[model samples]
Target: MLSALKRVLIGRPLKSTELGEQKLNKTKALAILSSDALSSVAYGPEQILLVLMTVGMAAFWYSIPIGIGVLLLLTALILSYRQIIYAYPQGGGAYVVSKENLGKYPGLIAGASLLVDYILTVAVSVSAGTDAITSAFPSLHAYTVPIAVVFVILLTLLNLRGVTESASVLAYPVYLFVLALFVLIGKGLYDMATGAIPQELHTPVGTPVAGIGLFLLLKAFASGSSALTGVEAISNAIPNFRKPAPVNASRTLAAMGILLAVLFSGIVLMAYEYGIAPIAEATVVSQIAEDAFGRNFMYYAIQGTTALILILAANTGYSAFPMLAVNLAKDKFIPRMFTARGDRLGYSNGIIMLGICSILLIVLFGGHTEQLIPLYAVGVFIPFTLSQSGMMRKWLREKPAGWGIKLAINTVGAAISFVVTMMFFLTKFPQVWPVLVFLPVLIWVLLGINRHYGAVGEQLGLSTGEPVEVIEGNVLILPVAGITHVVEQSLSYARSLAASQIIAVYVPFEREEEAAFRDKWSKLHPDVRLVTLHSPYRSIIQPLMKFIDVVDRKAKENHYQVTVIIPQFIPKKGWHNFLHNQTSFYIRTRLLYQKDVIVTTVPYHLKK
Candidate 1:
């Protein structure tokens, strides 16, 4: 039933032979890997405007300057991450680069920050997408959380289908969004060139507040940095590309950066030229589209695509976060189960976990993109800084061919990223306190996981290659319901296991019941002794556990082991199980926890 359900939800499972998933070519790779960066053009400009709006309309033009700064930073980041792809082909991106070139905690800091940022990315993206939906159709405003959660679920199922499958499914919506933005930019450009001058958008103007200062511009720059969050994804997932993985990954990273540059700068420029502002009811992108295309089918089409790509942009987190988690697990920083592949050859645990987290964030913030907006960039920029710094270190230490040029680029990138990271932290401080608190706790968790795995390895003696010592003698204890075929078989099997002693225990609630049990037990009292335990309160497991405890203590004193053999009858039909009280399970569960006690369940299938 479970297998059938899984097949129904995610399609049939592929064979192990088929698990070597088809390698992603550049185009599909961009669509699959670049959705987050590409889709951010939808909201990245608005995030900038949201900051600048604090200073009023006069300060809005600063978006052009802030955006130019962001693009230059993006260029440095792209250059540094491209080097990261080649240097670390095993695909740790920032975490590996930093862990290897920088110190231990630095790498951990990168990992934890990226982990948090990816979750924030999902929350921000889904909420923004839902905003787009409400923009197009305002009636669904009440169902924001539910709608966002449903989208998370839908994306999860699609991702579980497989990467190539999810990528294919997501590609069209992304393409549509990019095309819409280009058309918006092209038409806006034509208007400027032809002297048709697009007018400022005033309809549905939300909250007429405005202010401007250095602080506000700093905030805008930090917020707009979400566009750069997914830039490292392709670098981290280099192995997911076809042969010549590094080269393919490098080209894909370049392509993603170029697309992000065009779409992001184009949209921001258009908004600035068109005088679009942050509105309560509609987004800056939506407002720009309305001004450029008017309220027509094309306007609605662009809005639809925006909503889609926004929601699916969470795919960036889904695609990369799990792989990061698996790497952490490999380093013994997390549970090893994360390192296992899903039936679809994706990081199944990672994908599902990302979905669950995104759903939680969606519900927690009530699908308000703005409420969670302040915390978004804090997670991304720290890793950016750490990675570039690590790259600089990698070059200085190795001094490979062209290392001189690479080192200079990395130093510049690192310096810029470091400043952006600090700005993000200060700008989003109290709003981001939870994330700041979460990072240290996450590192502590990684350490704790490492300790536990190490302790388990030691206890299991996996490090020493020594054989486990076995107890010298064997004593068997069987709890019986009088003497039946089940008990008879259990005792016979117990005797066959080289049992030095075998005792059959019968618990009775009353003296009369004990006498009757003894009378019936006398018929099979040929070999083992029958010990009767009386329970005044009618607690079966409690009394049976005490007897096992006494036996285990005695066995330890004698340098031996006590085996508790539980004989149970399996019902022919499943419902028959409900008719039984499951006393054997209770006694076995209690006894298994006692030291020096061995537990064995012998099943007898009922014929009728």
Candidate 2:
């Protein structure tokens, strides 16, 4: 039934050979990979307005400068990641690139930062999406957290179904959002050019702008840089692309950069041109929309698309985290489970983990995008710095064609990203220190996992082909309930080992049952001796354990090893196992720590 549900929900499990069939083309890849970058445009402007509003109306004018600064960083990221795609064509994100060039600690730092960033991407995106809804209908404000969580679950489920399915489900909505925004931008531009401003524009008269300082401008710039969050996702997941993965990934990256620059700049300009103040529950985007088209159907359409693309943006993390986890697992930094693909040939475990983490953040932060914004850029910029530095190191060492220009570009990018990293580090220290705290802990964890795998490999004698064995006096003890065909089979199999001794012991609940079992057992097994154990407490495992302990004590004197064989009856159906006492499992679990005493089970399948 579970398998059927999985098949129904995520489609049939694909074979390893069918992997290539699941690769995504450019258009779908852009939608799946670029959602986070594009969706941030929805809340990126608002975050800036949020911080700048605290400084008063005068600081509002700084939005353009801060926005232009972020766009410059965006341009650098686009160029840097394009180089990354070509250099590490097999989808080497910051983790792989930095680890390969910048040493292990730097690589691990990059990996941990990206991991946290992806989690926040889902949280912030879903929260911003919910804000769009709450903006539309104020009555739904209280349900914002729950709504964000539900969106995470839905996005998680969609991603688990594989890339193609999710792209198909989400691509149209992204296109619709892009089209609507461009329409709004064009209409807004036409209004500006023709000098036809709306007369009934309703601007909420906010409290007068407060005192201003350089710190406030930095705060606003840090807040606005969220538009750069999803920029690296495309570079991180090149393996998910179609043939010519690097070429196609680079094209998509370029397209994403152009689209984000146009939309983000346009939205911020529109907000500033119309003098859309940071109002109550409504967002700056919503305010701009209403002023541009009023509270009509077109306004609702843009709001609807905005909500969808924002929620779907969580898919960016869903795709990247799993692949990154798989990479970490391969390096023995995390558990091996993430290395396995799901039914739909996607990294199901990683996707689910990302979703849960994102949901918890939403609940903890009360689904507020502004609250998560400060912590957002810290996770993002660390990786951006490391990735660009990794590329710089690569170019200097490789000296390929155009390496000089590439190195120069990556150098500037690395410098800018490092500055941004310190900006958030100083500005949002209280909130972002946890990320720094997690970095060394993540490195320690990776080291521990690598140590564990090494120890297991050594213990297994994997270095050599053969294991040295010394024969000892071995005794086989069959733990049976009563004389039956299953017991006979276990006894017969135990005899094949040619041990020093073979003993069959029966633990009975009552005296008569013990006597009857002995009488029946003596007639059938004349060659083997039958020992009956009587328990006063009527506990099955305790008496059996005592018997094994005695046997082990006796064997110790004789320089022998004791092996306990339990006969198991296999139920025809999975549910039928619940009907039995389950003593077979109990005995094995109890004997796991018995040194020199081996416990084994021989199963007899039941027909009905």
Candidate 3:
């Protein structure tokens, strides 16, 4: 039943050979990979306005300058990541680039930062999308947390279905969002051109919390840095593109950056010219739409598509997190299970883990977008700084064609990213100190994992000139609960091993039961010896383990191997097995820690 249900939800198991077909083309790739970066235009401008709003309505005049600064930063990241796409076509993104060019510790830091950022991507994107929903219908505000979590689950399931399939599924809404926003922006621009009067937004002017100073402007810029959150995703997932992966991925990255700039600039411009201030319930974009189109179909269309693309924007993290995990796992810095693909050729474990973490974050933050935004940019920018720094170091060392220009671009990108990261820490640290603390702790954990894997390899590694061991004979110890066909089958199998000796051991709870077992054993004229043990406390495993230890020591003296056979029976149905005691299982589990003792299970299948 479970298998049938899984088949229905995620579809049937795909063949390994179909992996090539799963790779995406440029258009679908743009939809799946670039959605997060593109969707930020919906909320990115508002984040800047939100920060500046603390200083009263007069501070709203600074939105354009901050927006331009964000665009310049965005341009730097685009150029740097395009270089990253070509330089490291194998595509580990920041983790690989930093590790290979810098050192292991730097690489681990980059990996840890990207991992945290991806989780926040889902949480922040979904929360922002839920805010969009509440913005449309204030009555649904109470259900925001539940709505966001449900969307995360649905996105996770869609991704589990397969990459190509999920991309195909998410592409339409992204394009729709872009088209809708363009119409709104164009209409707003036409009104401005035709000398239409500005609508009174009736924005509540809050008391000024901070003066208009350098710190205030930088704080607002740091807030707007959410626009650059998902930029690294394309660089990380270059391998997911079709043939000529690097070229296609670079083009997609460029296209994504261009769209982001235009949309972001247009929205901010519209907000300023229309005197649109963000209200508690409606978003800046929605407000702009209402002013330009006035409570009509266009207004709700922008809200519907905005809610959709923001939610679907979480798909960016869904695509990149699993890919990044696979890279980390390949390097032994994380568990190897992440490297395995699911039946649909997606990294199912990583995808599901991302979903679980995102849902937890949504619940913890109460689906508040602003509360989660502070934690978002630090993770992204730290990696951005590391990646560009790594690239700069690479160009200086390798000095490939056009190395000087590449170095300069990366140097600027790295400097800008570092400054923004510090700005994020300085401006948002009171609320975001946990992330600052988490980055170091996470890097330490990654180092510990790397050390452990190294130790394991050292211990398990075989020396070149080592001689192989040959075993001549073995001692078979069979543990039996009572005289039954299960015991008979165990003894027969043990005899076939041609051991030096076979001992059938039993732990009897009562003297009467031991006597009856001995009488039956004597009637059979058994070839193997029978050892009986007493358990005053009815602890079966304790006496059995003690006896096995003694027998194993004796076998060592005789140069014989020790093998313990556990006799068990399978119930006809899985649920029926609960009716029987699991003593055989306990004995087998206890024997697992014994270094020189071999354990085996002999099963008697029952037909019902």
Candidate 4:
């Protein structure tokens, strides 16, 4: 029944041989991979204006400049990531580049930062989408967190279906969003050029919060940097593209950067010309749309597309995080479960983990996009700097054809990204300090995981010239509560082993219970001897463990192997298992760690 439900939700299982068919073409790839960058226009301009608003209307003058600065950074990222795509077409992105060129610690840092940023990408994108919905229909404001969480779950299930499937589902909305924004920008610019709409002249009306200075401009620049959060995703997931993966991915990335620059700068410029201010209920884009189209169908069309692309933006994280995790897992820096693909050929574990973590952030932050922006930028720029620096090192070390130009591009990207990262730290220290603390702790945890994998490999590995020996004699012990069909089945399997001796060990809470069990054993005329252990505290596992210890010592001394056979009853219904004592479960669990002792379970299925 569960399998049927799963099939219905995520579609039928996809064969492994169909993996190549799941690869995306450029148009679908653009929608699936670039949505996060494209959708940032919804809130990126607003975040910039949010900071500049502190200084009153006059401070709004800096919005266009800040937007330009963010665009320059976007250009650098696009060029740098194109280099990354061609260089590491196998696609681990910053983590792979940093590890190969810089070192292990830097790679892990890049990995951890990207992981955090991807999670925040889902949370912030979904939250921003929900914000658009609530802005359009004020009544839904109270359910923002719930709505955002629902979108996360929906996207999770969609991606779990497979890459091509999700691209097919999301491609239309992404293109529609781009068209709507282009129309908005084109019409707004036309109006401004022809004086069709009256321009509101602004003078400083309220007291400036602080004197406009380098610090204020830097803060605004740092805040606006959220627009560049998902720029690296294309490089991270190059393998998701079709033939000539790097070229297709690079083209998609360039297209995304162009669209983002046009939309983000258009919105910022339009906000300034139309006297749009940050409102608690309405979004900056929504207000710009209203000013352009006056709450008509076009206004709602912009809001609708904005909401959709924003929600679908989370798909970028879904695509990137799992692939990055696969690399990390292959390196033994994380659990191996992430390396496994599900029936649909998606990284199910990684997708589910991303969903769960994003939902947590959404709930904790109450789905507020502004609150998550600081965390978003801090995580993003760290990897951005690391990736570019790693590329710079690569160019310097290899010195391939045209290495100097590539080196200069990556160096400029690295320097600018490093400065932006520092600015985020300095200006938003109160909000971003947690990310600073988290990055180091995450690095420590990743190192610990690597050490544990190393230790496990060393301990479990065989040495050269080691001989494999087998014991001829077998000593079997069964822990039985009472004689029943379950016990009989266990005894039958034990007898088939042809052991040297078979002992039935029983632990009884009361003296009368032991006496009754002894009588039952005699009535059965059992071939095996019965050993009774008293447990005054009624602890089943403790008394049984002591007896097993004694048996183990004697067996080893006599060169015999000890095998503990446990009789476990299988209930007809899963929930019915809760009604039983589960004594056999405890025995098997405790004996699993015992050296040179074998444990097995004989199951008796229940009809009712």
All candidates: TM-score: 0.93, 0.89, 0.95, 0.97
Better of 2 and 3 by lDDT: 3
lDDT (tens digit, per residue) of candidate 1 on 37-94? 8888887888888777766665767777788888999999899999988888888788
lDDT of 2 by residue, 424-479 (tens): 88877887788768777877888899899878777888566666545478888898
Error of 4 at 453 (Å): 1.3
Highest lDDT: give the candidate number.
4
Positional deviation of residue 83's Cα in model 2 after best superposition, in angstroms: 1.2
Candidate 1 regions with alpha-carbon error over 4 angstroms: 198-212, 462-470, 481-492, 495-498, 524-526, 569-586, 604-608
Instruction: State how far residue 327 of model 1 sits from its true place (Å).
Output: 1.1
The root-mean-square deviation over C-alpha atoms between each candidate and the true structure, in angstroms, is 3.3, 3.6, 2.6, 2.0
* Model 3 C-alpha lDDT per residue in residues 106-191, reported as the tens digit of each score: 99889999999999999999999999889889999999999999999999999999999999999999999999999999998898
Return model 3's CA RMSD, one decimal.
Answer: 2.6
Report the backbone clash tally of model 3.
0
lDDT of each: 0.84, 0.86, 0.90, 0.91
Candidate 3 Cα errors over 4 Å, as ranges = 199-210, 464-469
Flag the better candidate by TM-score, 3 or 4.
4
Where model 2 places Cα greater than 4 Å from the true spot, the runs are: 198-210, 364-366, 462-467, 472-474, 481-500, 505-527, 530-562, 569-582, 593-597, 603-608
- Assess candidate 4 and give its lDDT: 0.91
